[model samples]
Target chain A: MSRSALGLAGSLGTTLQRELQLAFSSPGRIVNPLMFFVIAVSMFPLGGRMSAEVLGTIAAGVIWVTALLAVMLSMESLFRSDFDDGSLEQLLLSPQPLYFHLQVKVLAHWLVTGLPLVVISPLLGLLLHLPEAGYGPLMLGLLLGTPALSMIAAIGTALTVGLARSGLLLAVLVLPLSIPVLVFGAGLVDTALNGLPLTGVVAVLAALLVLAGTLAPLAIGAALRISVH
Target chain B: MLTVANLGCERDERVLFDHLSFSVANGMLLQIQGANGSGKTTLLRILAGLNSDYTGEVLWRGQNCRQTRQEYQQALFYLGHAPAINRTLTPLQNLRWFCGLQGFSDDAAIHAALQQLGLAGYADIPCHQMSAGQQRRVSLARLSLSAAPLWIMDEPFTALDKQGVAELEARVDAHVTSGGAVILTTHHALQTRHLLTVVNLDALRTESA
Candidate 1:
């Protein structure tokens, strides 16, 4: 409707485009987490050589846990490069509120890092010998849950962005908060395996996504400001 | 029309500067001078709203900068110590995003700004391939591309050679003569059309004591 409003929307897209550019330019940035998710989950199956029954039950836990870690591994770079290169300061000085820009940033991250994890997840499930009934819930759950994981990792990354050697701090901050996503996501497959109704689990995962989408940005915006300061 | 009133700041239990007060208006150039650790960068960051640990207030058109952040930021441009260029990104891409944050960016303006900073024909190359000074120019390209009235720069001439220095000095001069204001910290002696307003942080410290 107005010039500033147009620019506000324009900046968000521009931020997304820039983030995608950064992520794609270094293909390893996107690929590493995917590899980690695959390799680490693969370890679960080979290490124990368990029977199908046992593997099927624990598959969701292993997959959800690995996916959560994959997002965190990819998430640290969300703001670290910007902070190191001083673009974080520029971001802080922008006239538009940081909330929307942060949403766009995490969205780009999800597109690059989270989407790939979702796509190859069934392959990982197959490797783990997941039950046929559980496959649908597993994919559906990750598709819904990983966005919330990405946002949580974004907050953790922003909180420790100012410090060097922040990996442990990132885990300490993110893993605890991620318990809800892990619980609900893994439970979806478990519930489906038992031939339970999917509506309640679906609603909870959707609510977590919505809740994270709205609330995480506020913390992310503040964390970025303090980090830059 | 920016003003600072009785500004004071401390870091690590040491008073870097106290009771510091100055104002920069249209068509004026203010240079902040001090020895190492005198807080020139911190002062600039405070004015730019990057640091909030300071005492006193910064006003943009007589309104508290904190309360009027959006309007104040829209009217201000700041270049700090780091070049702010992503090594993996090309100059064109970097400037596009930088100007986009301020809600204005176009290829024509970005190219012209790069050329102004002696970066002609170098826009497409990734910044990591460029030399340090060239990278700095990529960051400095924001000077011409922005319409904000007040610019606060810290050590903008850090890696520049003679020509780069002269080019930046001329750019700063043109900005001030055209009714824009600039506050900068640099070792390079600047010869501009307007008289320079210099603030020495060491002097402020002594007066406070």
Candidate 2:
């Protein structure tokens, strides 16, 4: 009873650890998105009427679309389980800043869901007959960009977590916001394929990351407060 | 001190309750009484500052609860119908995370509280393995570990056994006597040494609606 509360670092570590533990226990969460990304990406190579060069041209668009869809599909679980289990209510009432909790949840999410996609994307890029120059940009772009997806999707998930059927509603709410990410994300690889310097593409994706990194937590926090009430 | 003046809340275009007012100080146990679909949970949610769509203001130490939210929330604990423990987590992990958010990281206290709740052996196992009442116990263990002075609980007694019910009543009595205020909604008749102040939501429904 005499024990005092912790500082920011202490609680953040606890929350982050808890989030990771939850992710680990639910292997389906990690495996499902990855499987979806791989399956969806693998299908494009089998479609008829495309030469290797033609497939190579659309590789950036195809990979980016699948990655975006995987992240978006996985986004529903970000807050959905917490909301259903009532842990979200306790989370909202916690004395700690909601912003910190949002950061930890989204960070854990990106690590488990988004990070795997980024890691395996190079292989998927290869399968699609990506131009040799596009490989490096594909991985780098996803590394910077998927966090933005996770963050933005976290906002949409927070907004709709209260609903019983959040299926298409979540996608509709998140896709419009995610277009810029898809455009710049695919653009990075496309520019590299065209033998252009990736300076602008990388810079834009990084800026988006920073913007989503700082601003996402606030929006998600407010949305969580609204949904719970 | 906590105060509510002219409080009114409506849900689904139906008036839940109106003109409700009350106050609580240290060492008070207030029970909210109402039948099904009554505003008992809504009232607790408003008092806990979870629901904001209401007519009146909730005051904490003479300031608006929303205005002084940080300080007010710092002193409050809320347990709703959901056990709130993630199914994938063990009792210890769940308590560690929950108490961690309240700014407390005392692992020993969490352990002792779990043991007191008859969960010492069950602490490390995933909560999905536990029965319904035991899962509820994992959440109730917070009542013993909480340092917050104000507690708002909705249907806290729903899934408890006889012993669990008795133990929770004792815990509430101890908390109230030790200068913490508890507001809860329950159909179970409580047996406690402290005087219970009942807020009947059904009667208010008639008076207002």
lDDT for predicted candidate 2 compared with the true structure: 0.89
Winning model by lDDT: 1
Q: Weakest 10 consecutive residues, lDDT, candidate 1 chain A?
A: A1-10
The per-model lDDT (C-alpha) reads 0.90, 0.89
TM-score of each: 0.97, 0.97
List the candidate 2 regions with Cα displacement exceeding 4 Å.
A1-4
Candidate 1 lDDT over residue span A1-229, tens digit each: 1123236778887898899999989998899999999999999877976998888789889999999999999998889888999998998888877889989999999999999999999998988889988888999999999999999999999989999899999999999999999999999999999999999999999999999999999999888878887
In model 2, state the lDDT of residue A82. Answer: 85
Model 1, residue pairs in steric clash = none
Q: How do the residues B1-209 of candidate 1 rate in per-residue lDDT, one tens digit apiece?
A: 99999999999999888888888889999999999889999999999999999999899999999999999999999999988899999999998888789886577888888887878999999999999999999998888777899999999999998988888888888889899999999877777778989999988878767
DockQ of the candidate models in sequence: 0.55, 0.73
Q: What would the TM-score be for candidate 1 when compared with the true structure?
A: 0.97
Tell me the tens digit of each residue's lDDT in model 2 across B1-209: 89989899989999888888999999999999999988888888899888898998899999999998889888998999898989889999999998788887887888899899898889899999999999999999998877799989888887899999999999989889989999998888889999999989898887765
Docking class of 1: medium
Highest-scoring model, DockQ: 2
